[model samples]
Target chain A: MSENIAERVKKIIVEHLGVEADKVQDNANFIDDLGADSLDTVELVMAFEEEFGCSIPDDAAEKIRTVKDVIDYIQKQV
Target chain B: MRRVVVTGIGVLSPLGYGHKANWEALVKGQSGLSKIRSFDPTDYVSQVAGHVPVGREIGQFNPDEILSPKEQRHVDPFILYGMAAGQQAVQDLNWLPETEEEKNRFGVYFGSGVGGLMGIINSGKSVETVGPRRLTPFAIPSILINLIGGHLSIKYGLQGPNIACATACATGSHAIGEAARLIRDDRADIMLAGSSEAAICPVGIAGFSQMRALSNHFNETPQKASRPWDKERDGFVMAEGAGAVVLEEYEHAKKRGAKIYGELVGYGLTADAYHFTAPGGTGAKRAILQALKEADITPDQVDYINAHGTSTPMGDLVEFKAVKEIFDGTNVAMSSTKSMTGHMLGAAGSAEAVYTLLAMQNNVLPPTINLDNPEEETAGFNLVPHKAQEKQVTYALSNSFGFGGTNATLLFKKVLNET
Candidate 1:
């Protein structure tokens, strides 16, 4: 279940950043690998919030750095 | 300075689609106001407008008509309206320049206040639902105010200076005056000039409703809503249309055997800077005086004044005061055509100019309808209320004042001699 959730989150990141799914792995950083600016990152978080039906606060949004971080946050919130 | 004369005129107003029909309707004192059928205004405070009814077929985008189908789809309705009127002006006068120099020396000058409001509203909806990526590439070009001039230049193959002046409601007057200046300064032999507007959209209605700048008293009786100078007047009823006129140099037009209507004698422009939206009334007086001085005519020499009474309480009162100050108790025939056509915004100036010329040509002044009881402040002047009056008008002045405190006054005189 955990692996499945991580795969789903990674797919979303890859689609949002226009990158390959494999490149947006658990260990890869969003800025370094996925190539997202500050606004893009914020928008990505908003899309995730809407898609997952989860509320991500500003502080929690700041903590999300990678696809794995988003998966973890969604897991904890849901 | 060179002299300029009106050679041709065309219009698509609330009364009808052509000048003759509109003139007939005006002479019959018919009202064009009706309930808002273009959009459902059940929730809107102001629920009426003078809309050009749908299903009236303006000829297709043939090369002879105006523009191509592709180009027509990308432009706003105002531009389409302008093109229709421009094409009619060209056809009515059979203005076929045989030489390249004649074509090049002809230019276009048009104006619009709120261009492509319908386009903006559609784009706004698309952006909200499908995101900004769904916005069409032609959205900005279609909505820009100057596209009226661009479309005219392209359609007619005019190569001279193409310009557009967007000064809110005064746009039409400014455009006509500027085109005349081009002729007066010997810049162009012929100039296509006018203004158009299509601001009767959801956002436009909502914005004007929020500002309380539109009439709300006659949601049920829309025809009686736009009552200018009446004690019961509330606010102006929004209107949409276009008006165009072809101005040519006196000797040049006569040499080409063009039928001239009247001579454009003077144009005066001024700014109130008193308030953002309201006129100072004094500044309008100055503009009128400046136009009189430029025309070298006294107040009594002016026989008719087409007043820009928008039916708004403040606007009507301020225009009355301004006219009084300009005329100084002299008997001058004045009438607010907004009472019949509603407020055409940027198109009002040009539409009123056409009416003024028609009055000069026919020796009749159209009445200000819907005025059952004149307001206290509006009683002094000869408002020409209720019924059309017959008068021998030699010289006429038309005034148009818009938001941002901008004002323009134009003087026209009946052509007496070829020189």
Candidate 2:
């Protein structure tokens, strides 16, 4: 289930940002490494919540800046 | 006053995509109206629309050519149509402002009659079904009427005046007319002006259908739906498209050896202040007279008129009465290209303006198709019925009147010789 969550999070990021799957590594920051604005990051968070069937609060969404952050958050929540 | 001339034009209509294709199909008396395929219209009262054909044909529109997948997801179709037409015009003119000074003198003025109704509806449904937090971040910009101009200004790096007119069906005419004013006033050396519309969605059709403003009689025979001035006419057919023109100061265009289509000599706008949806003959007549007066020409000197004939019963006769009152005993031939392109709402005015220029250049007037049984009141005016006509057009007028009784007229004079 943890591995599935990581794959799903990466898929959502790649699809939302139109970024390369290879570039979406665990340590890759959404805004720094991937080309995503503030709004795009928020949208990606919403997409993750919908995919994992969990609610991501606003404060928590702001802390989710990297691919690993999203994977870790989802693994703990869902 | 600095004189203004049309340097380039672009059009994306149900008739065709580019201006050339649209002109060719138009003069051939082709009807672009068909059964609405963008959405299932089984529940809609008016099931026909003039949607831009999607394909790889010379004049057909391909969405992939205009926007990337992610960019497309961020905008509504109106913005895409506007950008497509605007890019065509910019490319046709080959005038890219490179220096900061030049960029500051370039601007974009585009509009839509009803902007992004589909986007709004879809966004609302998403928020309703899911939650408000699930809404896309681009929803607000996607539904903005002025985003067309905003997007164009950003893409082209235009730093001058960027604005939009939202006068319902008259949006295109108002945009072009006001943009010409900007050039004439020396605020901008060159301006891209036009209007786009993509409001043939379910709610748009339903709203107009509720007002009995759309034709529902000929859904099975879609081509015969928008019969302007004909006795069998019902209501206007909804359409989606965009039309844009590049307006430059006469001396500036001449200095650059630009190919001038024609000179925009007169622009007039007036309010009816009488009815919301119906035309007050007085205001339309005043607008026509105002344009002719500003052009310093009599009604007899005008050769052609592209009328705001939307195929509605009351609107057609009212506009005709106004034309007759103004052009009485004159040989000014008039035709409604809406008979072919359908009612493109905000795009109608600029598209008709482009058609008027083509008519003057080629000396061939587009026809008002489906006018087999012309109404008795339309007897005096040369309605250019059923087929295109070849006649040397000197001065032509394109008229657009919107729902709020806003009327605008643009007068164009053919340039016989290069100065």
Candidate 3:
């Protein structure tokens, strides 16, 4: 289930940001490492909430910065 | 005063993809109108349009051909057609300023009748069904009316003025005329100007249908739906496409040995202020006179006119009256390419300008196909019905009128001293 969550997060980032899938590494930052803007980060959180069938609030969404952050958030909610 | 000349043209029309292809189709009386296939139009009253041909019969339009897949996903279809046509115009001219200084002299002026109707309609549906969070981030940029100019400017690195006109049906013609003024006023040496439209989507059909502006009688025979100057004509058929031309200053074209298709000599614009949807011969007459006066020629000097003639019952009658009043019963030939291409809205004017230019080049007047019965008002004029007429066209005028009572007339004179 955790592996599935990581794969889903990576897929969303790749499709939404139009970045290469391989570049969405665990330590890769959302803005610094993946070229995501403030709006893109917000939308990425929404995508995670929709995909994982969970509601992420503002403070929790703010805490995510990298691919691993999104993967870990989804795993914790699941 | 710098003179404006048409050096190159690019057409992505419902009839075909390129200039020569559209010309051949028009001259041959081929109808690009048929049943709508972009969506299921079974519930709509007006079920036909001049849709750009695609699918297996005609090759699909790969947007990636002009824009990268990521970029293509964000823009509207009108921008796609506009970019393709704009690229073709630049390529046909073989003119891309190599240096940054030269690029600064090039500009773009493009418009659309209804921008991104499909995008708006789809996004509206998604909001109702799937909720607002599902909306794409690119929706705003995709649906803006002026993004055709934005997309083309980005693609060509054009550094001069970027203009976008949304004068409804007259949008394309106004874009061309206004862009010529930019060159004439020394603002830009070269301007890529025209219009593109992809408004045959569900909302476009529904909205126009509500206005009673679309044909309803010919759903069974879509080809005969747009019968300009015929008594049986009901209304105009919606269409989708783009048309573009590279307008360069005469000296610049001559210096570069660019092939000049025709010289744009006069432009006239006016407003009716009468009704939102209705047009009057009074405004059209004044606009026609303004153009002729600027060209410094009488109506007798004109050999042909590409009439707007959208085949609407009221519009055709008033426009024919306007033509008769402008020419005062002269024998100059006039016809509507809309008889074949339907009403392309914003793209209609530029596409018809291309046809008129081609007619001047070849001296072959395209027929107003399906004009089997001339309305009594059209009896004296040579509607050039059912067959292409070969004539020595020295000067020609193209008329485009749109909603909001806007009207534009462009005059082009053939080069007589070319040796």
Judged by TM-score, which candidate is best? 2
Q: Estimate the Cα RMSD of every predicted model relative to the unseen true structure.
A: 10.6, 1.5, 2.6
Report the TM-score measured on chain A for model 3: 0.96
Evaluated with lDDT, which candidate comes out highest? 2
lDDT of each: 0.83, 0.92, 0.88
Ranking by TM-score: 2, 3, 1
Error of 3 at B416 (Å): 5.1
Model 2 over residues B129-210: C-alpha lDDT tens digits?
A: 9878879999999989899999899889999999999999999999999999998888999999999999988899999999
* Cα TM-score per model: 0.81, 0.97, 0.92
lDDT of 3 by residue, B169-222 (tens): 999899999999999999999999999999888889999999999999999899
DockQ for each model: 0.02, 0.83, 0.30
Candidate order by decreasing DockQ: 2, 3, 1
Give the per-residue lDDT digits (tens) of candidate 1, residues B93-172.
67766678978899999999888889988888879997764356567878887888887787678888799989888988
- After aligning candidate 1 to the native by TM-score, how far in Å is the CA of B247 from where it should be? 1.0
Per-residue lDDT over A1-78 for candidate 2, one digit per residue giving the tens place of the 0 to 100 score: 898888988899889999899999999998999989888888898899889899999999889888999999988987
Which residue pairs show collisions in model 2? none
